[model samples]
Target: MKVTAWNDGKKTYGIRVGIRNRDRFFNKSWRNIEVDIEGSIYQFKLTPGFWKHCPEFRDSVKPTIREWLEKYNLVGWPKRKPPRFELVQIDNNKFRLEKYKISL
Candidate 1:
């Protein structure tokens, strides 16, 4: 997966994820959501008055690409892994990245 950031011209910024193979079976697209980036750590903030949902990222997000690495004990960014089946599940789940075999 890849993460990209775009500033909103003030101190605000939003993030749209490039999930390798996210079926999106349980979540919506990560568009228009504010995200904070600190090196390998990624954070998400929900605007006030908006209904919070998502069991994984309901209120806010403090996700790290490292966590995913820890979960799978893999090395390198989108590389060095023998294979990630979950990512495949995501590919089958989502239709955005039909060709997601790239190196960073």
Candidate 2:
């Protein structure tokens, strides 16, 4: 599964906090997660909460994007035939529970 993010030029763009196993209680594995930005700054994931679902990342260490995505459990989303807006407007977007799509 893959997600497409747009560069909004507003506050940071396209970054998302990975939703963990939502059904479970607190998880410590978040501490090991990483983020990578262009400048080589790194970030780590946090315990279960809004931080885990951040539309813009709020971590301390920044790892490579590849590493960040590797730890994330991706939810599949359909590609928009023609994006309606210059930037993706929503924070986390929406999940189609009745269907099998995660819209970003």
Clashing pairs in 1: 21-90, 21-91, 22-90, 23-90, 23-93, 23-94
Off by over 4 Å in 1: 18-26, 29-43, 46-104
Q: Which segments of model 2 are wrong by more than 4 Å? A: 1-14, 17-28, 39-41, 50-56, 59-104
lDDT of 2 by residue, 1-104 (tens): 12243233322223332243222322344443332233343433443443434433332333343333333433222343211111121212222111124233
Number of clashing residue pairs in every model? 6, 7
Give the per-residue lDDT of model 1 (tens digit) for 7-83.
23333323233332122332344442322322232334433322232222222343343344335443233423222
For candidate 2, list the clashing residue pairs, or say none. Answer: 35-62, 35-63, 36-63, 42-61, 42-62, 43-61, 43-62
In candidate 1 the C-alpha lDDT for residue 50 amounts to 21
Best candidate (score: TM-score): 2
